[model samples]
Target: MFRILLGREGRVWREALAAVLAAEEDLEVVAELAHTDEVPVVAARKRPDVVVLDHALPGSLTVPDLCEKLGAALPGSVVLVLMDQRGGALSTALARLAPRVGVLTTDATPWQLVESVRQLVRGETVLDAKVAVAALTARDNPLTDRERDVLRLAADGAPAKEIATELFLSAGTVRNYLSRVIAKTGARTRIEAIRIAQASGWI
Candidate 1:
């Protein structure tokens, strides 16, 4: 049997996923975690073969950090992301974290979920074709490389001065890049501009 750890913040989804996995003859859900911070601990304890994580977890634990931590703790374990239909940005971000990660739509049938789990257990990465195409087509990056670097740092809630220091540019230069990004994305403020850029896969 393939041991699994399910992670989700919402009670309803957690229960539903547990039930689905329990019905499988070759899968066993050994732990269910409610917070991202709990993942590493529980996974370490249970030594699960795969971890199924919901994208909507709380706290400052970004998906990348979660994947890295889990991989470090359990070298051979696979991390699969459970995302909603609209979670394009989150999918993109998670893709950058680990190559073994895959995204599955929440609306997928229980059979699909079980099959995906089986694929992960066999060291295969499985992303729905539609989600992969949508994510790739959405990669309409309009900003220049430098502008994207500035925008990404800004989106992480960094100040203009700090971003300038990190990017080795003057603060005024960073401001200029931000202005152009704002105009290009048709956003009224820096935060809105970052949001638009991220949504469109420009950052």
Candidate 2:
């Protein structure tokens, strides 16, 4: 059987999708997670052959970090991410992961989702055409991965000290990161930086 791990927030949709994938004769739903924080832990333990993840799965870690963590934990596994938007930090991150990563909009039919998983296992890159085009044409995100991480926390209204505690960095380092984020976004203040990043879909 082709083992599958699923990570998505909505209980109804998650369970329904699990049922569909599980119905396949050669596919099995080995694990499911509603939060991004649990994904790395469960995925590491389960070692599934494929991971079907939702881009907006709620948790502390950003989508990029979650994807990076997944890649590190299961380098050989394929990740099929269900996304809403076509381009941004999330798509950029997924693109960097290349053939091991597959993306489809949340509106993708269940049949498309199933076929994409099989294609991924067969070593074919699967990307929605519009998603691929937007990812390629979208302006590159100016912030590095670390900058984006710090900015995501800041966007959540976390103070530098709290951000430091969460990220295991010193308060001063967090402030520096915030400063760089502000400068990179060309914002005169922290709040403005947060707004700019959000509007640009960088965070």
TM-scores, one per candidate: 0.69, 0.74
What's model 1's lDDT at 18?
94
Question: What is the RMSD, in Å, between candidate 2 and the native fold over all Cα?
Answer: 3.5
The weakest ten consecutive residues by lDDT in model 1 span: 55-64
Root-mean-square deviation of Cα positions for candidate 1 versus the true structure, in angstroms? 6.9
Q: In model 2, which runs have C-alpha deviations exceeding 4 angstroms?
A: 9-20, 23-25, 34-41, 56-76, 156-166, 169-175
**Candidate 1 lDDT over residue span 84-129, tens digit each:** 6554555565666544677787878899999988887777777876
**How well is each residue in 46-87 modelled by candidate 2, as lDDT tens digits?**
999999988767677766678778888898898898886644
The residue-level lDDT of candidate 2 at 16 comes to 96
Which regions of candidate 1 deviate over 4 angstroms? 96-99, 139-186, 189-203
